[model samples]
Target: MRVLVAGATGVIGRQLCPALVAAGHDVVGLARSAPGADAGLAGVRIVVGDALDRSSIQRAVDEAAPDAVVNMLTAIPPEIDPKRLAEQFTLTNRLRTEGTRNLIAAAGGVERMIAQGLAYAYDPHGDGPANEDAPLWRKPPKPFVPVLAALRELEQSTRDAGGLVLRLGHVYGPGTIYAPDGSLLRQVRAGKMPLVSGGAATFSFSHTVDIASAVVAALDSDEAGVLNVVDDEPARMSEWLPFLARLIGAPQPKTAPAFLARLAVGSWGVAFMSQLRGADNTRAKNALDWKPRYASWRAGFATELGGLAAADAS
Candidate 1:
C-alpha cells in the first residue's frame, strides 16, 4: 500500500512514517518546510506542503499518488500556558476541522483514509471505560468545546469520505508530555502540577510506539467508524500521577482543592485532569488484530522513565 501522511514531522508522525515503511508500505510525508522534515524518515518521500493551503496539499497528494491518506496534522504548543490553555486549542481546532477537510479534498482518489480522534471527548459518565458508542460530551466545558467540536467534525468528515477514525488515548512517550524532557515532566519535577482532591478522573494512556503500530494496523483494515486506541488499563489520576512521579524520581504530588485547581488550571483543565472518562480499546484490538507492546502505563511509564534515567547516568 502507498500511504500519504500529513503532519509527518509531528510527535506521532515521526514514529509512524518509519513504522509504515517497515510494514512494507511506501510512504510519503507532507512537511511544511525542508528543515521541519526529519532526515530520519529514511524511506519516506517528503513533500513540502502546508495542510492549511488546499492547493499545496492537493499538489502534494497528486505527486504522492497514494492509495491511502493519514491525517496526523496538529498544532499543539510544546508548553501550554495554564492561564491561557484555551488559546492553545485554537490552531489545533482549525487543523482538525479545516485541515482535515483540505486533506480529504487532496486525497480525492484515495480509498482508505485514517484520521486522528480524541478519546477524551466522551462525556464523563458510566461505570466503566467509555467505548466507541458512548456519547461525546454534549456540553463540554468552555475551553474544550471548540476542541471537541473540531474532533467531531473531523470524524464526521472522515466517515463521510469512507474513512476510519482512531479515537486515541492521551499519548505519552518520547517527544510527548510523558517524556523525561517534556513539559509535563518538567512540571512534575518542579512540583507545579498537583492532584485535585483525590484526582478521580480516569485516563487511558497510549504510548507513541503502540499508537504507531495501531496506525499501521488501521492502514490495511476495512474497519470503519470509530475505534478507541488506548491501553488495557484505565486508571484514575491519583493512581497514575503518584506512580509517574515515583518513576521519574519526583516528589509525590501535592493535593489541591477543586476550587484552587480550577483557579490555577482553569475549569476545563481541572475537569480534564480530574474528571475525564477513560476509553476502552477492545474494539480496536479485535478489529485491527493488534495488541499494544506496552499494555499498561504502569509498565510503560517505568520503562520510559527508566530509560531516561539510564541515559542520564551514562
Candidate 2:
C-alpha cells in the first residue's frame, strides 16, 4: 500500500510516516518546505507543498498517487504573530475544511481518506465519558460559539466528503504544545501553571504514536465516519496536573478559585480547565480493532515526562 501523508512533518505525521513505512507500506510525506526539514524522515519520499494552496496540494497528491490519503495538516504553534494569531482559526479551519477538500479531490483514485477533528468540541452534556454519538455543541454560551462554529464547519466538511474524521484528543508530544521544553512544560517547571478551583476538568489525551497508529488502522479498514481517538482513562485536572508536576519534579500547582480562573483565563479557558468531559474510544476499538498502545493517560503521561526528565539529565 502506498500512503500519502499531508502535513507529514507534523508531530503526529512525523510518527505516522515511519509507522506506515515500517508496516511495509510505501509512504510519501508532504510538507511546506524541502524534504530534509524533518529530521527522522530519511527514506520517506518528501514533497514540498502548502496544503492551504490547493494547487500545491493537488500536485503533491497527484505525484504521490497513494492508495490512501492521510490529511495530517494543522497550523498551530510558536508562530504567534498578531496577524497570524488572528488568522489562527481561519488557517487551521481552512486546513480542515478546505485542505481536506483539496486532498479528497486530488485523491481521485484513492480508496480511503483519514482527516482530523477534535473530540473536545462535543456538546458538554451530562457525562462522565461521551461516546462518538454524543451531540456536538455548535454554539456554547459565549466564548465557545466562534470556536465551536469553526469546528462544526470542519466536521461537517469532512462528513459531507464521506471521509473518516478522527476527532483527535488534545495532542501533547515531542513537537506539540507540551513538548519536553515547550510552553506548557516550561510553565509547570516554572510554577506558572496553577490548578483551577476544584481542578476537576477531565481531559481525554492521546499520545502522538497512538494517534499515528489509529491513522494507520483507518487506512486499512472499510469502516468510515467519526471516531474518537483517545486514551482509555481521561484524567481530571486535579489528578493529572499535580501528577504531571510530580512527574516533572515541579512544584504542585496552586489551587485557584473557579471565579478567579474564569477571570484570569477567560470563560473559555475556565470551561476547558474546569469541566468534565471525556471521549470514549469503544467504537474505534470494536470496529477498527484498534486499541491505543498507551491505554491510559497514566502510562502516556509518565512516558512523556520520563523522557523529558531523562533528556534534562543528559
Root-mean-square deviation (CA) per prediction = 1.6, 2.7
Clashing pairs in 1: none
Which is the leading candidate under lDDT?
A: 1
Q: Cα lDDT for residue 291, model 1?
A: 91
Candidate 2: Cα lDDT at 21? 89
Candidate 1: which stretches are off by over 4 Å? 36-39, 307-314
- List per-prediction Cα lDDT, in the order shown: 0.88, 0.77
Candidate 2 — which residues are off by over 4 angstroms? Answer: 78-87, 141-143, 307-314
Residue-level lDDT of model 2, residues 182-267, one tens digit each, is 77888788886677767877789988999988888887787777999998987788888888887877889988887876655666
The TM-score obtained by model 2 is 0.91
Error of 1 at 150 (Å): 0.5
Best by TM-score: 1
